[model samples]
Each structure stands twice: as structure tokens, then as C-alpha cells.
Target: MGLLHRFANPGRFLRLAARLQPWTNALALVLTGWGLIWGLFFAPADWQQGDAVRIMYVHVPAAWLASAGYVALAVCSVLSLVWRHPLADLAAAEIGPVGAAVTAVCLASGSLWGKPMWGAWWVWDARLTSVLVLFFLYVGHIALLRAFDEPQRGYRAGAILALVGAIDLPIIKFSVQWWNTLHQPDSITLTGAPTMSTSMLWPLLISALGFSFGFAAIVLARLRAAVMEQRLRVLLLSRGNAAAGAPS
Candidate 1:
């Protein structure tokens, strides 16, 4: 209730986003640039895997966001459904393609890394299979949201689908553990501490945070555009109505 009221007004959201956007964009740029330089140049190569291990810097973060973005989409869907906030629906719709792109990057990079390390381009492993399903879910959401002539109906249906597809998120997380797979287990989780050394893990963390904020900034920019477009549509419709009512 309180949350809904705070952001319900487009004016308020626009102001808040305007202020936050610069900070987020700056932070994303700095962190991503530093992370990439450190990962690609300074970080020690794997003794066994050698240069191929560099791919993890990008692959791991993309895989993480592929699932995390959907969680965000689901939350926005719930807000749109229960509170009927127009901005929430717009944000969710705008976020779908970004999430899909990240998922594809994760899969493509993973395949490239696999060829040298695992002796094949791809295998129907549990983790790989579930991530593929996640990709399809993103595709379905985008398709369903644009399927109807009435935009609101399409958004409503898409929200329902987003919420339902969220169930697969947990499955994707546990797929590697639940099955004996070739993919390495999670490095960041397993015990009280991360499995990697500070030198390796720090850059990965920075890069992941950068990617998250980058996604947010893009979504906010798209949402702002959507709001303005809607406003223009309303203005045109009102003018058309007035002209039709006048003596001709």
C-alpha cells in the first residue's frame, strides 16, 4: 500500500528516476570498466583450463542475471496486477528483451567455453537445459504481451505468464545439484565463504553489480519513453474527439 502509493504517480517516478539515473549510470560504467580490465589482463589464468577460464567473467554474471531479471519481472507483474500501476506494467514489458539477451549471452558463451574444456559444443545437461527453458520463457512473455489488439489485455496476460514462469527460477538454480552434471558447482555459494580467492572473486562481483545497474538504467529509460508515448496518444485522441463534436 505505502509502496504502491509512493510510485503510483508518474510525475513522482520520473523525478526520482531522473535523479538516480546519473549515479547508477556512472557507477555501472566505472565498475564494468575496472572489472573487465582486471579480469582480462590482471587475473591469473587457470593452471588447467588456461586462457579459456577467462570466459567465466562474462558467462557467470550473465547466467546470474538471466534468473534474477525474471524475479524482478515477476515482482513488477505482481505490482501491476494488484495495484494497477501503469508504470509497473511498462517496466515489466521493457525488461523482457534485456533479460532474454542476457540469457542468450550466457548460453552462447558457455557453449564456446565448453568446446575447449568439455570436448563438445553442448550437452543436454540439467543446468543447460533449464537455462534454455528460461530463454524460451522470456520469448513467450514477449510474444504474449504483444499478441492482442488491446494493449491492456496483452499486458494482463503477460503478467500472469511472468508470475507463473517464475516457478522455474528455483529449478534452474538447483538443477546442477539435483543431477550429476559436468558443469562446476556454484562458486559463490557452498559454505560460509566463497570458493575463489579474493583476487578472482572481487572483479566478478564488481562486474555483476555493474550489469545489474546497467539493466535498471536501460529499463528506466525505456519506461520514460513509453510514458511519453502514451501521453501523446491521449492528447491526440482528445483532440480528435473535440474535432468530431464541433459543427462541421
Candidate 2:
């Protein structure tokens, strides 16, 4: 508990994040590129769906990150409200739009993949509807945070919304199992075996990992920018005040 607070300072976090960003960026680029090439060309096509299944490498990662990002935002919001950690608030705020973007990608990619498989572009399936709602929640979170003149008020509102919106996560995760749906059940699970063979699975795993790291790199960079902007604004405001108080 005591050690965790040591990194609560924005300066220390900024230094740590700066040191880590380059490695993460390079890794994201390398791994994602490798996964794309491997999945598209090297991996065997699906016996049923053919090459269209290759789209899973992209769609699955986007969908995974979209949900994971919101969970992160909610946890950060909890820390912000309970501990009043400024960095937590900043992280949550930055995650909102990124999550939304990924969710949109997931939906778009899924629709594209579904058109041939399902003979339709979309259906109001449980999983799809819930993910769509999650996207909307992210957008609302971003908008609410920017709606107020006082930044703290906006943060408070956004935090509450994030916490409340967390109810959707479990529903999204369980939707295919709990109800009749056009969406398929889990292809991979922890307790059971993967439905896919090694050739098909490796590229998907690599893509997912690369995208996850990419998300972290982007978020850390955004957090650093927000911290810098805040510091700059404070410095400028202080200078303006000092100049106003000085002799003409």
C-alpha cells in the first residue's frame, strides 16, 4: 500500500512511462505486423469459412481490447473516487475515447465478417447489442467529462457513469451462453480446450497481444500529454498572475 503511493506522483509516473513507451511501440509494431502476415498467408484457411476467417485476427483483438479498456477505466474511476488519485482520473479520462474507437472497430469488423457467414450484415444478437451499448457508454463518458466548465465536476460525473456502466461487461461476456443468439460461443476458453488448431490460433494470439500492448503504449503517451498540458497551463497561469501583480 505504501509503496504504491510512491508512484502516485505524476512526475515519477511520467518518467517511468517515458522509459517504457519506445519499447512498447516497437513491440506493438513488430508483433502486429508479424501476426498479420502469418495469419493472412501462412496460416491455414478455415475448412468452412475459408479465408474470410482470417478477419478474426483483427476483429477478435479489437473486441477484446474494447471490453478490457472499459474495465480498466472503471477500475481507475474507483481509485480516483476512493483515493482521489489525480493520475487515476487522468487515465480513466484518456481511456474513454480509445475504448470507443476500438469498440467501433470491433463492430465494423464483425459486420464485415458476418455478411458472408450469416447471410446478413447484422442482427440484434445479445453480444452485439451489449457491445454496441458499451461503445455508447464510452462515448457518453467522454462527452460528460468535457461538458462542464469545472474539470473536477466533469471527472466526478464521468467516474459515476463509468462505474454504473460496468454492469454491461458481464452481460457482454455471457450473452452468447445465456441466450439464443446469432453470435457464436467462445472459441477459446480457460477451463476447456480451444476450438481451433495450432496454425489458426497462434496468429490470433499474437495479434491480440500486440494490440493489447499497442493500447497500453497509446494510453501512456496520452496520459503523459495530459500531464504536460496541465503543468504548462499551471505555469502559464502563475506567470500571468505574477505579471499582473508586478509594478507597471
Candidate 3:
């Protein structure tokens, strides 16, 4: 709580994020570029799917970000609702568009992968449907954040929507198990060893890490810009008021 409040100060966050941004950007580029090259050109092809399995490297990371990004947004929502921190609100606002884009990537890659393996571009499989719902939830959160005339009201409303929409995350994770879906059960699990061979697993892991770092880099950059913009607005408003109060 003490730590949260300390970083919740916009100036403090800006300083910290500024220091972290360049490093994150560099790491994201190096790692993602390396992972994509390794996955696409060097990783052993799946016996079953052949080169088509390469898409997993992209799809898996986007899927991970789609859910993980929403979890971050929900945490921001909690901070806003419980503490009414404007920084939390700003963070949540920045997360929405990025989250939505990642989710779209997840959906598009999944569709492309499916068309090759499943003979169709899309299926109403349980996991696929749940992920689609997650995308819509992101869209709704973004919409609510801008719907109100007052920014505070918008933040509060968006926060509530984010909290409620969090129910979809669990559903997305378990959808394949709960229903007889076209999607397969998870290849990787916390309790069980990965079903995928290490040759493939290593590249996938690297790709996911790269995407995670990239996502963090983007959100931090946007949050810093938002804080600066808010400060500029406040400065301008104060100047306007001061001018009005002074003699002509």
C-alpha cells in the first residue's frame, strides 16, 4: 500500500518510467526479433502441422497478452475504485487500446492457424468464443472510459466495467476443458510438464517473454505521456484563471 501510493504520484511514476522505457524498448526489439527469426526459420516443424505450426509463436504470445493485459487493467480499476488515484485511471486508459490490439492479433492469428489445420477460418469453439468475448470486453472498457463528459466519471464507470468483465478471464482459461471444443487442451500447465518438445518450447517461451516486455514498454510510454498532458492542462487552466483575475 505504501509502495503503491509512492508510485501513484504522477511525478514519481514519470521519473521511474522514463528510466525504464529505453531499456524495455531495446530489450523488446532484440528479443522479439530474435524469437521470430528462431521460430520461423530455425525451430523444428511439427510433424503433424509442418510449417503451419509456426503461427503458434505469434498466436500464443498475443493470447497471453490479451488475458494478461486485462488483468493489469482490472488491477488498475481496483486502485482507482478503492483509492481514487488519477494515475491508476490514466494507466487503465492507456491499457485499453493496446489490449484491444493484442486481442485482435490473437484472434487473427488463431483464425489463420485454424484455416490450415481445421479446414475453416473460424469455429465457435469454446476457447475461441471466450477469447472473442474478452476482446469485446476490452472494447467496452475503452468505450466507457471516453463516454462521460467528466474524466473522473469516465474512469469510475470504466473501472466498474473492467471489474465485471474480469469474469471472462477464467472462462477463457478453462473453456476447452469445460466443453468439447475444437480447440485443444493447454499444452503447458503449471502442475504438468509441457507436452511440447523443448526445441519448440524454447522459442515459444522466448517469444512470449518478448511480447510481454513489448507490452510493458508501450503502456509505460503512454502513461508517462498522459501524466504530462494532464499536467499541461492544469498549468494552462491555472494561467487562464490568473489572467482573468488580474487588472487589464
TM-score of each: 0.95, 0.97, 0.98
Model 2, span 1-248: residue lDDT tens? 46557888878988988999999999999999988889988999999999999989999999999999999999999988998876888899899988999999999999999999998899888999999999999999999999999999999999999999999999999999999998789999888999899998999999898999899988988999999898899899999999999998
Backbone-clash count (model 1): 0
lDDT of candidate 2 vs native?
0.92
lDDT at 16 for candidate 3? 93
Q: Which candidate achieves the best lDDT against the true structure?
A: 3
**Candidate 2, poorest ten consecutive residues by summed lDDT:** 1-10
Better of 2 and 3 by TM-score: 3
Best by TM-score: 3
lDDT of each: 0.88, 0.92, 0.94
Question: Tens digit of lDDT per residue, candidate 3, span 32-109?
Answer: 988889999999999999999999999999999999999999999999999877689999999999999999999999
Cα error of candidate 2 at position 31, Å = 0.9
The runs of at least 3 residues in candidate 2 whose Cα sits more than 4 Å from the true structure, single-residue gaps closed, are: 1-3
Candidate 2, 12: how far from true, in Å?
1.0
> Model 1 TM-score?
0.95
Superior by lDDT: candidate 1 or candidate 2:
2
